[model samples]
Target: MPFLRENSGKFSPEKIGALIMVLFPLALLLIRALNGSFTPPTPFGAPPGLGAGPGLGAGPGLGGVDPALGARPLVEVIRFIGDWAIRLLLITLAVTPARRLFNWPKLLIARRTLGLGAALLVGIHFTFYLIDIGSLGMAAREIVLRIYLTIGFVALVIFAAMASTSWDGAVRRLGGERWKHLHALVYPATALGILHFFMQQKLDVTEPTLMAGLFVWLMGWRVMQRYGRGTGLANMLALAVAAGVLTALIEAGWYAVATGVDPTRVLAANLAFDYKISPAWWVAGSGAAVALASEIVLRLRPLPVRRAARA
Candidate 1:
């Protein structure tokens, strides 16, 4: 209902659009699931990247199946839902930056919807994980012992708290300032989710690297905003480059340590696009696109001029 209603209790185009955006991913998941597209999952998660093509189990490194899932329909289902949860979380965090860039305050209407969607998906993701295990006791013990599971469970708890208190009554009880502080936990929760995602990867980490880069850009943009430089084109360009380089370094470091590959070769892979486009370039290209949009917005919708105070 909130997704369909504005704060004034009237249906607005913004809310309608937001509702569609919120449900589209779920709809895709349902369509795919019903079609038997979801198959067994990899040891880490699903496939290596989007380029690996559609469907749940349509990627390389499909050899290492999650023992818990063991060819269950829920194996790929868990990964699919979990990935979308992180996705919505990132999109929710992007709301503020996007609003400022395009001067579209209406975007705020969808922020909570996106966050709630993320919360729901993550809950489902965990529930599927439990169902796949087929034993509450074993699942509970795994959460306690496995570092990745522990981090993911903690992040889920934080998401639950945020979602529970997202209503008007909670806002009234907690007051605006305290509520703001409580919701700020989204950042750390996202970080932990990202860490859990990274640690779970078995072979290819294309999406994880991109996720990390975007997270880096998001944090850097916030820091720049604190210093009153967030909206500048030069600042954005710098942040973009920094984020991309960091992405490359993250991927290189992971390959070097995890697979015993040379870090320099990994870095060089970013330059050679013969096989793939690499996450670093994707991160940088995304930021550049944002910067270009901001420029167009600034020029086309320049702020109104103010006259001097009357004497």
Candidate 2:
């Protein structure tokens, strides 16, 4: 990746990674579209907003439609976009942590690329949401009035602001300190975006839970690293363990309140291997892998002093 190589040209690894981020999601959408996933609930060329308004029961709002081209497709498409948007957002967040933990300073080169890619995904996600609802007028009203939509809209606005200011010209015009402060809005933007995802789901929160756990780990690692607790195998492992436990607790608490279920059962599920791996284990394993890879890289790279002496 150009991000990894200092002397690389236009097709840098970082640029490639960012391109993949965009193309992969676009490919999925294309596949779904070709498979008729974007087919409307009404006829193929139905006029805009005939009977497909929010309350008409043919869109994402309430009423259901034909099985072949039902509202489910719209939901699936919106969700597909939303999921990728959140993943890219997390990937953008991970650049700093990965750069610091792995001693790969060039990783910062990809941060803007990933961030802009995420903003694009969020933009597409919102556009699909509007298309799914079938009416710009009703969609605008719903976005303004609906709690979940409002939250998502706010997150998208934040993304738009950040993306707009991502260029060097914007930085110079805004001043470095002001730009940094303005861009810090990403923290809340990501949080609200994830919460919007969680709230929109009526069931099967495994993915959202996993996303939330990862967000915690990425942010937590940054905080720990900022405090001079330098990256090491032991520290990374500890943080992973703590993050895993926190994930379990968060899932348990969510279920406890949302369904009045036994929190113990949720906690116990994390230990049982028979069932599919839980989010906590996934988070822990990912963190551990990063730690292991960092250690391997550190050990393999020759010391700066030794390299200079040899030269």
Candidate 3:
């Protein structure tokens, strides 16, 4: 197969890995469609299993159900898959910023594929969500009016616009500056997506918090790049601010977990005051502070000069 051919004259592990990463999800979907095993396989012959046996109808076998639950197993599975797909997309976007901080420039190549895959997964997720909503005999207007649905729709539209122009041809046509300007839409798209999740989630804000932190880190890098690493007093002040923010967020998160309250809901509902804090917020804030401190120290510390002798 042309795909299997190693044409780069180097080890093709990355090429092979990339292909497998792209195909594996689709392969799983195909298997699920054919076998009707929406959920992951359980322990061997475990009760309420997805095996091909008489117990299937009793809720353990393929398509087995009580019929009164109103929703199929397949539908639930699709929703779960879609949720995780968006989460993966957010993580993929973070990869670039993370790599840059670590000085790994080669990671840039994988960013486009990761982004496109995220868009594809989100598109599939929207399709499934729409299907499920329609199956309930609900009006399209009702679904659109939902906060989560509306935000999700906006996020998808942004992703679609970006994805359409992801190719080299589109980049050339738009010019690099214009293309980059357009791509900045990703920031809002991610924010909307996080909002959607924050609204839809029942209890934990862990995932949304992590995504928010990543966004902060990515954006902070840009700020640092713009401002020459601040002077001694400026750096101290910046680090102090970061430390205070981190401490507050950590304390709030701890309080929420202790009281069994949902931090996401608190933030979403009370936009005016009482900002929600999460572990991710702390991690991002503290990490950025430390990174900034390191950068400043490295820049200020004079390096030993090498002496050159002319004979």
lDDT (C-alpha, whole model) for all candidates: 0.77, 0.77, 0.55
> Model 2: residues >4 Å from true position, as ranges?
1-10, 37-71, 302-311
lDDT at residue 249 of model 1 (Cα atoms) = 99
The Cα error of candidate 2 at residue 136, in Å, is: 3.3
Q: What are the TM-scores, per candidate, against the unseen true structure?
A: 0.86, 0.84, 0.60
TM-score of decoy 1 = 0.86
> In candidate 1, which residue pairs clash?
none
Sorted on TM-score, best first, the list reads: 1, 2, 3
The TM-score leader among the candidates is 1
Over 76-106, each residue of candidate 1 has an lDDT whose tens digit, in order, gives: 6777788778878898899888877777767
lDDT of 2 by residue, 216-278 (tens): 898879777668666678988888888888888888888788678899998998898764688
Compose the digit string of candidate 3's lDDT tens values, residues 1-311: 13333445554453355445555676777777788666533222223422212221222212333345433665555445555666666656656544444343445555666677778877787776556555443525644555566677788899999999998899899999999998989878887876675554423444445555555555554456457443233553464455445434533463376456675554443233343444444554566565675455545652223210110
Clashing pairs in 3: 49-60, 56-61
Please list all clashing residue pairs in model 2, or write none if there are none.
1-13, 2-12, 2-13, 2-14, 3-14, 57-63
